[model samples]
Structures are given as C-alpha cells and as structure tokens.
Target: MPSLEVIDEHIVLDILSSTVRLVGSLLPNNIEVVLHDLRNPECSVVEISSPSITGRKKGDSVISGARRDPAFANLMEFSSEPITYVLNYETQDNAGNPLRSSSAIYRNAQGMPFAALCINADYQQIDKAIALIQQLTASELNPTFKKEQQVIISEPTPDNIDALLQEIIDIAMEQNPGSNRPAIKKANLVAVQRMQERGIFIIKGGVEKAAKALGVSRYTVYNYLDELKAQNEGE
Candidate 1:
C-alpha cells in the first residue's frame, strides 16, 4: 500500500462524509455515517440524524447502542467489498415498528476499504413516491442496473494497451447490446480518440493516472491504441 499523507486522508474523509449528508438530507429518512479503520477493523466511528423527527440532533451518535448488535456485526463483514446491502425489513426502531436499511462501502487509494455509509430511508414514503412518479409519468418504473467492471492497470507492460482497449470495447458492447457493429466500432473509436485527446499515452505519465482519465485500465488504453494502429493499417 502506498503511504497516504494526512491531508489526503482528511480530504477523502471529508468528501465521503459530505456526500452521505447531502444524500441523506434529500431523502425522507435518517442517515448514518460510519467510518472504520481498515487498518484496525474493530474501531468504528458513527454519526446519525433526522431533522423531521430528531431536530437539531443530526450529528449525534445513536450507533453506540447498536454497535454490538448482530446487524452491525454483519455490517462489518459486508464492508469487505464495494457493495450495497439491504440488511433486513424486520429491523425495528425505538417505537417497535419495522425498518429497512441500506449500506454502501468505500475504499481508499491503497485499495483498503475503511468506511460505510448506511441510510435508513422511509420505505413506506419512498415506495409511495416511486409509485406517484410512475403514475405521473404514465410509465412503468423499471430501473436498469449496471455491473461495475474491475480493470487492473499496472505500470505499462508490453501487453497493457491491447488488454485495456479490448476491455473498453467489451464494456461498450455490453452497455448497448442491441447496437449495430458500426455503432460499436464508432463508440470504440470515440473512446480511443478521447484518450488521445487527453494525452494519456504520453511517455512519462503514470499508468494509474492514464487509466483513470480513460475510465479504463492502463492496459486497456495500450490495447486500444494498438488495435487502432492495426485497424488504420488494414484500411
């Protein structure tokens, strides 16, 4: 793992905490922010609030009581991956009514995951809102979910570019399965052109930086360029 400066840690924590608060505020429920020390998995820092119900106590730590609960124990285990889990529908609040909760995990630069943001949305209200939206729009509510792909990019080896480009092409195809061959080709061309325009293939830049810019692997970038060169020759 790379050594992260204190400033970097602070920046990451701030961004994540702010994002959780913003999303929570927009929804009709309470939100909880939990920070874990990935380096020391036993320690957890938690914050929660609900203005409509709790008022002015949004940053209070209500998690102290639930920290040792089985639900929380399961949450710690779930933090091992970058995933969102809908824990259970039977979990109850202080009033003894059922509750639903969702959680998402985030990782840091060294690929060490250290935090989770758990949201307790008003399931009844949200369901009603969704139904209302669908009725207002006169359309069935069908949401599309995309799987996130992992593209690994090490320091550029001889095979990096070829691999990266192929992955990009694959993702484009997967995203638009009904797209014609010409459309797929055009999309891949756009991807390659964008990378070039961003100067990712520059001789001195780090592989990770190039990969991030292209939203693919450094290997993918290398592969795409190689394929582009071959296609141009064939033309």
Candidate 2:
C-alpha cells in the first residue's frame, strides 16, 4: 500500500480542484479562489481564478506577503496546532483596495502541510454600504477593521505512529496544564480517549504505539479506552 502521505496528497488535490470550481460558481466574479502547492514555492499557485482582481495567476510564485506568515513553519515544526479557519478577516491588495478573505490549509499523512485554498473577495462596495448604514443608524457598533491574513486549516494526519502518539499525549496533558501524576494519568486517559475518537487505533500497531508513548502497558491503554467507553455510555 502507498504511504498515507501519497494518498493524502492526492485527496487534497482532488478536493481543492473540485471545491474551487464549486465556490467560484456559487459566488460572484468578485470572489477569487487560489490554490497553492507549498512544496513548489517558486510557482506556488497551481490553480487560481479571477486573476485580474487578485493579480495572481496559475504558476505564480508564492507572494511576498504569504512567505512571511508564521503558520507556514507549522508544516515542519508540528509543535503548534494550526487553526482550521478564521472568518471575517480583512486584508488588501497591493493597490490598497480592501479585501475580505478566508483560507483552508491541507496536510499530508506525514503531518507535512502541503497546500492552501484561499478566497479573497473585494469589499469596497460592502464597506461603503456599511458606512452609509452606520451613519443612518448612529449605532454604537464599531465597523472598524484591520488588515490580516487568513488562518491555516488542516486535520491532524498522523504520519509516524510515535510522533502521532506523542502529539496526542501532549494535547491531552496540555488540556489541564500540569505535570503531577494524577494530572498526567487523567491526561493519559484523555489522550487515550481522544485517540479512540480520532480512529488512531485503526492503524496497524497503533495500540502498541499508544502504550509506548503513554508509558503504560498495552493493557492499560485498553483499560483507559474501556473506561472512556463506559463514561460515554453513562452520559
């Protein structure tokens, strides 16, 4: 079988290709969708529509601004959990026309983030209408906005079992924020609970990996999983 990385890359490409068309058709021409393949940063933008508005065309290199986004490092670092999406964000084109934007980030099975699908819609007319309405109502609502980039979005794709298990353990422990044994055991339970929720145990030898990462016997992981099941059923 192919590594999950290959499978994930193919799936992500198919998703972006189809989703881009769907979004473009459902929205006005003012809305543009651009897909970037991060591995090929020199020509990062693999697919794009409404090039005239955003000034980005297929085969264009990574934009200077996007090259600076901190989340881009998450592809390699894997320490920070990137957000799924951020809505109602503001940004601008080089010419200073305001833009309302959103984005989704995608990763491979190895937890290597690889692509992004971004939507940028011009908001000049919308801003003008809002200003008029605000003036008419004299409301206290603040219409002030600031420029920002879209958030990164990706599901956790566990590549190496060890790395994936360690990440889950970290997430579980971090939830309550402590290092005590009771805290750690509770976190271990939570970690086991989350692993089951996300189907991490479906992979071959996942139980062994979880046991090693949690510093518990395989029987203990099973007990935690059973405990989680009982708790869920009782609730």
Best by lDDT: 2
Which one wins on TM-score? 2
Deviation in Å, model 1, residue 233 alpha carbon: 68
Q: What are the lDDT figures for the candidates, one per model? A: 0.46, 0.63
- Per-residue lDDT of 66 in model 1: 24
Which residue window of length 10 is worst by lDDT in model 2?
64-73
Clashing pairs in 1: 160-219, 161-222, 161-223, 162-222, 162-223, 164-219, 164-220, 165-220, 165-224
Cα lDDT tens digits for candidate 2, 165-219: 6887888877867788788789999888766644446334567878988888999
Q: Positional deviation of 31 in candidate 1, in angstroms?
A: 7.1
Score every model by TM-score: 0.34, 0.45
**Cα displacement (Å) at residue 132, model 1:** 19
Q: How high is the lDDT of residue 83 in model 2? A: 23
